[model samples]
Target: MASKYRRGFDITRDSLRVFTREPSLLLLPALSFLAVGSAFAVLAAILFQQGLVESVVTNDLYKYGALFCAIAISSSVATFFNAAVVHCAAQLFEGNSTSVRDGLAAAWRARRQIAVWAVVAATLGTVLYILDEKFGVVGSLTRAVFNLAWALLTYFIVPVIVLDQRRKLRDQLRRSGSLFRETWGESVSATLGVSFIFLLVALPGVALGVAGYFILDGVLAVGALVGGGGIVVTAIVGSQTASAIVRTALYRYATTGEQVGPFDGRDPDTVFPEN
Candidate 1:
């Protein structure tokens, strides 16, 4: 267990280094968030103009349906951007120079696949949300478990969409599941390491926000809030980018049995070594 955690931390540290080398990669997630936020704002405005917002808020069926569509749209946008980042990270692993333009182009090329997967993911997410909202504690627990399982199973979906565009969506999902099974231990470790790093990164911002509530006044307090919020956002985006890069590296190592410099140097055989 100790060895596993060490390896996970090492992999995450290396992943962060790779991200720092190309801070531009973090722009993908930032852009995705911006685009999705803009879209949702526009959507809300339209709904309000149409006087459907009241219905959506009051009607259970309409509410869930609207939530479903919103979640689906957000998921699709996120998947598209994530696929782009995966493409760029894969290029980096291959020693090829890539920019945001290259990543966007790659994502555009795989847009259809991303759309298909997004619908599947959105459907599952909507169902889970509905279950948790409508049912009692048991339903909420089930949704939580299923949500984690879904995340674990689809860890490599972005890489598959970026690297194996020819495969059908179901096939890609199956491949992701298989690859994840082989590297579940490492994946968990990497996730934990990333989460820990994120916590560390956000701690100062959190402290500032708390201190602002007590010590600062008016404009200074608002400045603290904005500054702290910016740091938290940066940390979130950085951690997410690192996680995606690590996922891409793991997928390449698992599929090609080749080490890609500092990103991946583990033995292919050891990926699923004999017990």
Candidate 2:
């Protein structure tokens, strides 16, 4: 356990170092969030204007259907940006200079794969949502288990899609699952470290928001809200960028038997022990 934790910490620290070297990698998540938010806003406006929102809200079937569609759209946007980030991270690992524009271009080239993955993800998400809403404690527990499993299984899918454009979606999924199973320990450890760092970074923002609500009023409160929000956003972007870097590095090590950047000192076999 100690060894696992140490490995996770090293990987997380190295990921942050990569982010410090190329802070622009953070822009991918910000752009994705903005694009998806805008799309959802437009969708909401259209639904409201057409009275579709009211109908959907009143009917469970319509609500789930609309939710599924929204989730699919959002997933596509997320996959596109995630692929771009992975591409840029791969370039960085290779010691090649890259930019946000270059990353975006790579994602655009893999748009079809992104769309297909998005549909698959959205369907899964919709089913999980339905399970949680329709069933009681058992359903919620099942959804949670499935969600975690899904996350682990697909951890390397973005990198696969970014690196191997010619492979079909099913092939990528199979490869991702195989890779993750082989590196499950490292994957769990890395996730633990990232989650710990995220909590640490986000705590200040949460405190500030709570204090603002309790002690401040009017303009001061508004200022506090904005400040808190900005801090949270910064933490989120930083954590996400670090995560992408670490994930790409792990995937590269798994497939190529070559460690890059922060991974150079670590033994690839140890990092991804046999299942």
Candidate 3:
């Protein structure tokens, strides 16, 4: 049963294969989300520099409440889109020959449900923020609970909206929670498997990005001025690209039960040779 989240898809072989098959294709959906999410991140940075964050923090009795909420909401939207794209990418990664148009259309089809999920998530996130502010809990404690819930909820929305293709928003969200309990172990492994891949990519990318930026600075005085923004953006895109690929792999491994060993799958849209 699609709802039997316990028979979790095998991420070891198939997950990596998806990214290997179409390295370039993996980045599109994530980039789409990044385009929106990163814009907010950039805007937040600008506002912080302008003392907007400081002023808000100082004036409000619940200084960090709004800040936390905004960040949570932004991250929620980003993750939702990422999940949707992961579904689309999984289809393509499995040799489905689907166009980005079809992939995106599939996601768009579930936009209302996703939007609803995001709203629910945002509300819960805000409530948690309020609780933290009121209680003055440690930051680490707050983060662990928040991220764990987010991780658990990860496959719920994707499975409900994209794979299940349900029309009603409530049905999707409701089904997701139910689905999580069915195969809790497998569902979690799949997420962790993919998350590990993204983390693997992050380490090298950070080193390269930072090293590259400084190298450019050494050669060209005012390198940060001439190309700082572009370099930062490139680093971000690079990390997003890697993260997206791993996510696409996880989706395939989960949905299709296909194992994608390193370099073992067909390139996206590739024509197979006749035996």
Candidate 4:
């Protein structure tokens, strides 16, 4: 267990190094956040203006439709930018320089695939959302299990879409799953490693927030909470970027059987053997 975590830490650190070199890759996740946030805001406005928010809360049809639409919009936008990130990361791995435009162009070229996957994702997400909303703990547990499997299987979908020639959704799904299966250990460890590292980084801020709640009051307490919350939020964003880099590197290795950039010289089997 310690070894696995160490491998994850090393891989995550290397990915962060690559991220620092091309800091602009951070823009993709930031744009994804803004785009998804804007979409949700517009969706909320539409629902409230139409007085359908109450209907959504009461009527299953309204609720599902609203949820589906919201999921579709957010998923589409996020997946689009994710593809862009993967494209740029691929360029970096391939010994080529990249820019945001290059990434956007690659994603734009695969817009149709991204749209189809977004709809599929939104449908699944809506179903899971309804189940959790209506079925209580059982639904939540079921969704959690299903989501984990879905995440593992679809891990490389964006990379495949942007970096491979497969166009059909099923074809893309198969490719993603295949790549994941081949590198399941390192792939999972790398992602979990990124999360664990960020969690550690965020813990201090969380501790501050808790400490402030107990020991401080008024504006000072609020300020402490805000400061701590800011740290956590920043860590979350940084982890997203770092996670993207790791995914790109993993995808490149799984597909090409060669590690590039910071990932080079690391033997996958020795570093994080499959369990």
Q: Which stretches of candidate 1 lie over 4 Å from their true place?
A: 1-10, 19-23, 210-216, 261-275
Top TM-score prediction, candidate number: 2
Residues 1-275 of candidate 2: C-alpha lDDT, one tens digit per residue: 56655565676678767756578777898998889889999988988898897789899888988898899988899889988888988888888888899999999999988988988998999999889988989889999999988898899888889896645877998989998987777666666777676777788888888878889999988888888877887777767777777778888877887777557787645653433
What's the TM-score of each model vs. the native?
A: 0.87, 0.88, 0.62, 0.87
**Candidate 2: where are CA atoms >4 Å away?**
1-10, 19-21, 267-275
C-alpha RMSD of candidate 2: 3.0
CA RMSD, predictions in order: 3.2, 3.0, 8.6, 2.7
lDDT rank order: 4, 2, 1, 3
Task: State the lDDT of candidate 1 residue by residue for 204-246, as single tens digits.
Answer: 8987887778889999998888888888878877777778877
Top candidate when judged by lDDT against the true structure: 4
Looking at model 4, residue 216 earns an lDDT score of 91
lDDT winner between candidates 2 and 4: 4
**Residue 140 of candidate 2: its Cα lDDT?**
99
* TM-score of candidate 2 against the unseen true structure: 0.88
Q: What is the lDDT of candidate 3?
A: 0.54
Off by over 4 Å in 3: 1-13, 19-24, 41-54, 61-69, 76-80, 93-95, 138-143, 167-170, 205-275
RMSD over all Cα atoms, model 4: 2.7
Residue 110 lDDT (model 3): 69
| lDDT, candidate 2, at 246 | 75
